[model samples]
Target chain A: MINRKSAAALIIGDEILSGKTLDTNTQTLAKHLVRMGVTLQKTETIRDSVDIISEAVKRLSESHDMVFTSGGIGPTLDDLTYEGVAKAFGLNLLKHEATIARMHEIQPNLVLNEARLRMATLPEKCDAIWTGGLWVPLVCVHNVYVLPGIPRLFSSMIESIPSDHFGDVPPRERKILWCDLAEGDLAATLDKAAKEYDVAIGSYPATNNDSKKLYRTMVTVEGDEADIVIAAAEQLKGALNARYGTV
Target chain B: MINRKSAAALIIGDEILSGKTLDTNTQTLAKHLVRMGVTLQKTETIRDSVDIISEAVKRLSESHDMVFTSGGIGPTLDDLTYEGVAKAFGLNLLKHEATIARMHEIQPNLVLNEARLRMATLPEKCDAIWTGGLWVPLVCVHNVYVLPGIPRLFSSMIESIPSDHFGDVPPRERKILWCDLAEGDLAATLDKAAKEYDVAIGSYPATNNDSKKLYRTMVTVEGDEADIVIAAAEQLKGALNARYGTV
Candidate 1:
């Protein structure tokens, strides 16, 4: 079966909104998806509201091929990922016997709080995969995979997911070149090369705080084909060298 | 005059999409707007596309009370913020004579790389304020404000925005409490207190990493009134303590 290509990530938390924390999951997931040959089209950060989470899940799942949500899956009252996922899929959340059993194995002295047990509840019609060392399963709803908000846990959970689970992994490559020349000085040449190679070129400039006189510009070339990507990168490096004497 | 509340934030970069960077600007702006009594209900993140940036500006300005964009204001090829803002407002991206003069004054020996000077270009219809330091101008388009992506710079830029410019600020009375009790165990108490006090309660549960025996529950109480917020918070604390004892 030919799987769809688009994906989206929803990061749920009030901490993110409050500027109390910086979210790393979205970027990590986006890069992972890109490598998987999936196009990450949209990313949204929403407050921990069941209504909002449910709405976002339903809408994104319907529109995109895959949807990944991070955060709000803990045992606290603010963790409403399970409830939201259930509501989104119109499924009843019941504690899974297997998950409860696994929890006991992981923590023999674990005191079963009703809130913590909430983590064991999975939406109907979904398969759950345990991420990291956590005993609770990361529930997968349709094409939506719910992961924890913790960066370490999120990374581990993403790794646990088989590449083939999403679909065929497409070949993607990136090359970077650093130059002392400014971007505007190379805009025309870079734009011309980008069009010619059908590649994407991203130029980032940074000022050296130490010297205050020297500036470094990094140009990134990315595409699906290795030959095209390498060729475009070489072209960019050559153009930069010709335009501005080599550093 | 009853000034309507509106605002927008622009995030410009490929780092955001590539998952190399998680944007904290939206959340920061959202919370700030909420504190300022500005209804920040919508936000979008787009690449460093001049066309996309211009279109975002036009649409957001037409609907929102204000628009604030973070990123794409740098001195790189991807930094299309100035041109984008100009196009959106049908203004010319000309070197602001005053701003250029200030730049020369601040950094006399500054090799005005056309790229570095790119930072001085501003839309004709907007006012510019120096945000990062003495030379960088924070361009303001009507109600829209353009900011840099660097966390410190973004925060400083926002702080420099006078509250009077945005009309009445949002009420900032909010309180938080931690409970050892599970959310489901205290659901009834929380719901009853919320309804009685007419306040909003958000519960977040986290698993204990060390013991994994008890789940840490964080309850947030928010309202327009200080007394009501405190009262609700007290009720939640009392109920959780009664049920599961103190944390």
Candidate 2:
């Protein structure tokens, strides 16, 4: 049996907490995960403190099907994500010879300072996915995938991760149409449509300058099959239109 | 005594959970609060659910010295922040006559939909701080300031919030410079610096392409006072430099 339930993103870095960096990774991952039929339940940002990072890693790893941690894997003293992650799984940070060699290959002229080489350290028994660069190394520990915090690198590394390795869940296509209708007014109709189609319907309202304001309701219907989503969306649109006219 | 310690940000939106919009409000507010000498301890994101919104409002209002809320105060069905906040405080959501009059003055040709008019409603006993378009009315609930989620609007509203509202506490800053040192190698020193300063000092390492494999270390000292921070930074920098010499 395949676990098809939960996912989480643990963003690690002082830059996040200090507000020096805005976390785009959480949103990006959340959207992507949802598209992949994975429910992203929570996203947390913890400082680069080892205790906090370790605790977060342990808790999230145990609870979620997969955990993606971004940031704090750099060659800096403040970069404690690797060590914290290693400690979380009770693994020693051993130098992975292949990773070091890859690092050298990418930047042959690169200095091999102990700090720079630290990027090659991985938890024992962990699978290191080398999206190699001067930035942090992306590695997978248990169900957790650690990537760099830099938005560009983070996104690229995430894309490089094979979706099959995470799980073989069917992709779900979700779409939304907005309307100007009071939630209370549309609640019963939406409920009927939801029950009829066995789909979830969310009704939200948006007000406007006219006393006859519009509700920007998002009627999202999702399923493994594109036809199912489209059919549900059409039903909702028709019901809403019948009541409020063209939105 | 005025407690000038804790601050919080309330992210109000259904779109956030629906995955329609990525929240930048929390990050922006957190950064501002940190720089203003206020410790941003918690952030809450709630949907347009009235009960949840009200509960969050009451709880967070009582907990933090300053609270910044973004989204859901717009003229839309999903925008129920004003009503929820009013209910949370057990106050009436009365249309501020002045605000209504102002709205009328600004958009005389504008149709006054009940939903749009709802935007002018204010919780009794709260102060209103107008930000952005003359047509929109933004307000504050106790220490909680309600702002729109549109990046520009949110930022503009933030400007109206008095900077000195949280009072003054000096921020500590420390800088560290080390060459050819890995974080693990300097763990003991880093721990000592943190203990000595009775604050947080972060270590960041950067790699180079030198023959000696040089790495630059960034030690950040954070405290409530400048002197203690500078002293700790100087001590750590001196020790590291003496051990490794300048790169």
Candidate 3:
């Protein structure tokens, strides 16, 4: 493989934990990081409570190269990510003038009430990076990047972060071996090949989408080194003795 | 509010971390626990590693009343939940005759290879709960329940667990106030009503599904008692001065 910087994601929202909303941010961040050649080490989904957010931020930021936090940054009552992140770093929240200016630019005649002003409040020593002609700023405190819960805003903000910000990792090559053999029957061969190869080999059973199994089992062998990855997959395919025949 | 037990979920799989798969298990468990009147407090997603699983199980199980783990229990090489659970409890995995019998019943004349036998081998203190005519067991080690990652099997296995297993909690009532006001405009009012009433009130801005906004903002007032829940929603509606009027 190649040397790659690792990152973790912290998703903050009560809607996710209560089953009221499905979390798409983690997946978005994951796929984005993959394209940037950064490995997403871990992800956590938690409620919007300040204590929980603060603790998770501290924990995740300590372990990984950087941490990306999604949600809980709106002007609503439940939005407490700024306060939580500030508390995590022993800093304070300050109303950022740039954020208010951007907000006024978007709404033109926005009423600068306490409710609207809450969006301008950010952690001390943090940078409010604006983008996409949207008023919402992607707040960065140290290595922790705080983002909004809205999917549109989250996706654009993540995309705007420069690829070099995560250092550089060359893209990896991947190959797949498909077979009619069920996961149980295909397990032993995969185990053997994985031990002999330096690549990541994963076996996935075909899932029933709407109770209909539409595909056969698939085994993936992937690594930054293309030659070894391809060789590993080729070896597995050649040695396979499929009771149900190869797919 | 009525008394309720809280639970945490630990989801394990490399595919999830690598963005190769989207996780629906956390949502499934969250919705299921909601039906049982149990509160799901937190959810964590991590790579498929023995040490990571073992540590997460210990930490989550200690903090919450119970914990549910999804994935890494298959017969594949990467399946490591049993080993992790055993390490967490200082127990050893032992081969179970019942699981082998079930495997035979499902795929008669099945070979009991090491890979297949791995499915029958479980933690010493764990209880293998069978359901839905599937050979895969819902292995429970004390307050931690390990389940398969596949959505279809995860859904069915979670349903088979008895309600009383989580202890009894009367159902909670929920009421909602829909409005055309944007989230920034609705924030202050929600903050006021949530503080006044002893209820969990959450404000959600409308999302753009396929880049099209299909609905307006929604505010939920929920608690164990119906009287106060409805009162909270109604009070917010009466006090609401919607610039766009209430939806």
lDDT of 2 by residue, A109-191 (tens): 66776756777777878886655363345688888888877677777787767778657686555656666655435555665
Per-candidate Cα lDDT values, in order, are 0.73, 0.68, 0.83
| iRMSD per prediction, in order | 4.8, 6.6, 2.5
Winning model by TM-score: 3
User: Highest DockQ, which number?
Assistant: 3
In terms of docking quality, model 3 is medium
* lDDT of each residue in B69-88, candidate 2, tens digit only: 78777654456888888888
Which sections of candidate 1 miss by over 4 Å?
A1-4, A75-77, A83-98, A108-114, A181-189, A207-215, A238-247, B1-8, B27-43, B50-64, B82-95, B110-121, B178-193, B205-218, B235-247
Q: Supply candidate 1's per-residue lDDT for A80.
A: 82
Write candidate 3's Cα lDDT for B137-214 as tens digits.
Answer: 888888999999999999999998877887877667776666767777778888888899889988878777522243
Residue A71 in candidate 3 has what lDDT? Answer: 90
Cα TM-score per model? 0.80, 0.69, 0.93
Give the runs in model 2 whose Cα sits over 4 Å from its true position: A1-4, A58-63, A86-101, A104-112, A117-125, A132-137, A176-247, B1-4, B12-22, B42-64, B75-77, B80-102, B117-127, B132-144, B170-223, B227-247
Q: Which candidate, 1 or 2, would have the higher TM-score against the true structure? A: 1
CA shift at A126, candidate 3, in angstroms? 1.0
